[model samples]
Target: MDTAERTLIDPTHFREVMGHYPTGVAVVTGVVDGEPVGMVVGTFSSVSMDPPLVAFMPQVGSRTWDRLTLAPALCVNVLAHDQLELCRTMAVPRPDKFDGVDWVPSTLGAPVLTDAVAHVHCRQQSVVEAGDHWIVLCAVEGMEVTRPATPLLFFQGGYGGFSPAGMAAKADAELITAVRLGDRARPQVERLASRLECEAAALVAISPDELTTAVSAYGGSATMVEPLGQRVPLIPPIGEAYVAGAAPEVVERWLAKVGPNEPGLVECYRSRLAAVAERGVALSMVGPGARSDYQRLHEALAEYASGELTPARERAVRTVLAQTRHFFDELDVLPDETYDVGAVVVPVHGPDGRVAMVLRITQLPAGMPGRVVNGWIEELRTAAGCVERDLVGRGAQQASDYRDWWEADFPM
Candidate 1:
């Protein structure tokens, strides 16, 4: 665009357009008057390599910069994903921003924020005027990566983290390949089912509102509930575990199909989700006088599966499902309590920390001991962990292969 056309763009439009590009978060810290002083900046960048130069832009009127620039040296602390509060603390105008923060003096007497992903100590090199900002350049004297955690990212006016897109794509591809090759978690599900003496199923979510049973195993004396390849709506009793950690939009989409639209119902669902997060499991226990309710639920599920449920029956089934959606949500809260009957579902997380699959055991025998139930829950968690580890390992290997190919094709 020409200079006149660029000048025509408003500040809001300029910010919005530039915000599309993600930036790493950092806090520029220095000692002023023998006290620690810092300010957060999103424009920190490496300027030159041979000269070991770094640069950051601060608003022309920024008092923090006016004071920080007086210092002989500065330290750029790269923030981690967990250091968002610290970033905010440094951004706002405060007299004692480092009162509660932990840090140590760098070699050049600049404050180095603790727990940062990395830190670069630099000496003031030069400064230049850039429109309404001052571009301050520095000569890097020392640098060190303090941690291996993900760096905090600022994108489109929000804070987030990054996952290797190549790795994520490969992970999804591998999962789909496994499904196409009929390499389900059948062995793991069957072993757990036999050990727990219950009906166990491995379910993969095809969408926010749909899950397909990849594998199912029924114990010799257990009742068969769902079969392999059975596609079911992501509703309660069987699907809440999968929905608990899903994105807010996905949760809303699934909840729109199920009722409890009232504020109280929303709170209940939120509580249930919190419970699931705390317990790492979702439960559906058949309390006293609830056998008939479960029988109706089973009938409703079967009809839904067969596509034979009338519209009225479908609504009724959904109502029932919503009522029991949070049945196990409180199990973790009341861990000391014993339930007469119920099922337990646990989610296995992939490398991206998303629910890759769900392991479910249904139809627990009544009057089962709480100790045994706890043991079963632990075993389920262990099995889920194993699946997660295997998937992560595979994804890592795939990422390595891609890196090798890229390096060979485009040497740097």
Candidate 2:
């Protein structure tokens, strides 16, 4: 290849190629003339560790940069995965952009976003001229990771968050569809949580082997609630409500993962699944004096969710989940058995009659009688019905297409 034969690089091609790389989002803030000023930048990076220098590129004629450079000091606030809205506001050039932003001044009088993943206080050291941009350098004064969380990322012209590769895996297309289903069920879920005085949630099957709590509401004296997007294993007994009505392959895949092939263990879960489908509601009973056992199960699930479990540790967690079979052996409870209900779940159907999502209630008042438990399940079923009607009215299908978005096919 000869330099004389090379074609000039176009700006469009340059940006499009670079956009394939992910960048951390940051908001540079400072006090200028008694007012807080900020600008969002994707070009924030460390220049050198020896002198503690940082650099960010701004358009050559950016008025926001011109104003910020006048300030005595600047604070670069690295955003967390949950701060997308905040990033949008800071990206615009407006005097009142900081109207509702929460922040405090650093020792050098630079504003630091209170909830940012980190803050770096620095003073302008130099600026270099780059084509169509200016590379502004700063001598770092102080920096710390204020909130240790996954940093917000910008990739391919959109914002997204990070997931650990070794942990809970999520397919992008499947996740998009799951989120869509959950959004449609939010109104009913919120209503149910308020009416039942417990934690209510909508779980979507983001993958064949797992369901994620997409929408969750904690209402009425609720002390514990599973975090939204919490992945729940679809393994036997733990999620019988979901598997009871799943497709044949899905059901088979779920059953094969049973922890122990005890003589009748597989058959036991099969019977429970059939019961769940027949009963229209699945109940988990934590009979009196089983709180510690339930607690152990909850701890194991939490450990699994952390995405840092070793292979042996994950097996231990699966074993813990498997041992909870007694709780789901609840198709016919005698009136004499006082029930400490753990969770109640009901399936929400789509327009196509497939189970799109399941409405679940947990953190209920323990030591409840079977009659009271029945009433709660009845209320949950009613809510699920309302959500189903809403989905049908809106013409939502069992599975909506998101391949174009996740597959990167844009027709502009």
Candidate 3:
């Protein structure tokens, strides 16, 4: 080291800035002296492929690292998003951390966690002395992705799972456009939510099969908050308003997912879309008897939001949603009839009259009169009209341009 190169860096500032880079979470476990030993590490990474090598940096004075050094081999269990508690248990400094933990011995004689996304069995190959840490290199013996789920991550002193921003059918620039449109609707959404005493949100079709919440506002007793980028499935009965004016092929592809178990439901949903197109707004209600069905719909939507479902799981989720079709039953809105409003949906259109975005209101006061719910629908429609006019002022979202962008990024 050159004397001129010596520089003093503030430890707190260094840690603060470096914390911005997220790292994968893993628990290194090994059996030593007939006892299981484990410690959580956010510094796990592969260092070489030619020699099948990996490395993790442990604090220089870490007692857990010191204890694990005696083991013949160690296994790195990549934690899944749902294993934060498990990670905390392994991270604690204790002698009986593995008690009641489900695990088995790996091929390299190291403890492999049962529900980890992956297990990498390795033996220590080199211990490089680094300032304030030990760069423990390992010769990879075997590795396999076991559970294959979204891995847990550490960022800015907190834990969160990966939400793929690129999971949409549009590119970053187009997504920025969507956000801009959402910004145009933000004020209106907030105002409508306040006036209606409910939740209001702007949703954009990121893909044919999914729509992400671009903006949201809550008022009154509405406590539900939709994350700005939370994606919801576009299956039947869920997003009819978003696609009532869509191209025939787009609507057809959406309807085909209605499932075959109930043959009559195909036309029923088809009529629902037609009604949405005619009324220019979608209306649904949850009666006292149907509240359980409404909760089931919400649960199914939450599962779809995870974006981690396998084909079988996705099919199962779709079935759950399809079975809730009775919740979206047609409403004639008799003025004197009392209704428990479920949601109000209206569309924001492009220049060519294509359905581009949707405004939805949910979590409303139950047991409202049909006339009151009708007034709420009018408010949502007016807000959607304002956003549409604002979008026109920007001269953006021309159907040709939007279609080109969508097709270029993701084939329809």
Candidate 4:
């Protein structure tokens, strides 16, 4: 053999070494020989969601790949944490990988592991050569999640599960050894918690055995706090080791104590909500205790803030508020318990064009010199650069149209 040729590793040996790096496991299932057939793979990944597509790699000379390409439809089943053994069984040289495996035929006649966390059915699209593997692209036509389970993880040539959020997931070797040194690091953790507005940062429990697992695998250390009156686990959500969402005033306070980085602070606030949204956050409500009703109020106001509250949404909000007001109005209280409420449209222009009108609802602080109208006018002037009467007619029409949609969809 030539010297250069001898130095190059064989595909088999290279694959074995690459296996050490670890990857998520998935099962690519399709109809073969008039029956469902499948192979385990770790290279499956999403390609796109618009017009939906998915892709995975199959070894170039794989007979399974050849069979899969002939099928009309395929199912990619993302394995759960306990499916590592199934993946290993399918990886070996075997004629019947599904002989004793638990699976069910999907609607498309593709094998779907009964315990898979999620399964997506797709039509075969195309295949392209990529190094020593054939990249198989498929158009996802149908999908289902039969089970909800944390995923399996492969790393360092072995299988493992993920730990809960926080330091357990990403702490390095130095942090581990430092923990063994004891209470010396407690102050730092407390400082971190105080700064983060979250408790339980100091006594993080992690070990070498814990590092091999995947994300959200193990829970954090058991620690006690006075407010809770009991010992609780402290596992911060992922990436919170750096910073989290805070009010501008809170951020200013943190900077005063710990100093600040201009770029990092900007990125922290920008990325916090953006990342959470990506992770499928449904609802978020922020404000003071009394205004906890802000979410509903905001929705109602947002409808009209553009000067277009559909008559239906506006009417619904108005009806609800009216009912509450009627009940409160009937009840006897000190100083006659007078309440002032109203809405105004103030135009705001930035470097761009007209942005929005600042909407405010103020409960008057009794015995004041000025009437409620004065407060409303002062608020509108400060909230927006320009006050426009045009808002009333334009918003009323839009609100009427919106009311039509709400009436049709939501009968209440």
- Candidate 2 error regions (>4 Å): 1-168, 171-173, 333-337, 402-412
User: Model 2: per-residue lDDT, tens digit, 201-289?
Assistant: 99887666678888888788996546777778776777778888877767777788774556478887788788888888898878777
Candidate 4, residues 7-108: lDDT per residue as tens digits?
A: 778878987888777688888888778766788888898999897999999999998787778888899998888788888877775767788888878888
Models ranked on lDDT: 3, 2, 1, 4
Task: Tell me, by TM-score, which candidate is best.
Answer: 3
* Residue 320 displacement in candidate 3 (angstroms): 2.1
Per-model clash counts, in order, read 0, 0, 0, 16
* Model 3 ranges off by over 4 Å: 1-114, 117-175, 260-262, 395-403
Error of 4 at 176 (Å): 16
Give the alpha carbon lDDT tens digit for every residue of 73-145 in model 1: 9999999988899999999988799999999999999999999989999988989998889999999999998
lDDT of candidates 1 onward, in order: 0.74, 0.81, 0.83, 0.47
Better candidate by lDDT, 1 or 2: 2
TM-score of predicted model 2?
0.56
Worst ten-residue run, lDDT, model 2? 403-412
TM-scores of all candidate predictions against the true structure: 0.50, 0.56, 0.63, 0.42
Candidate scoring better on TM-score of 1 and 3: 3
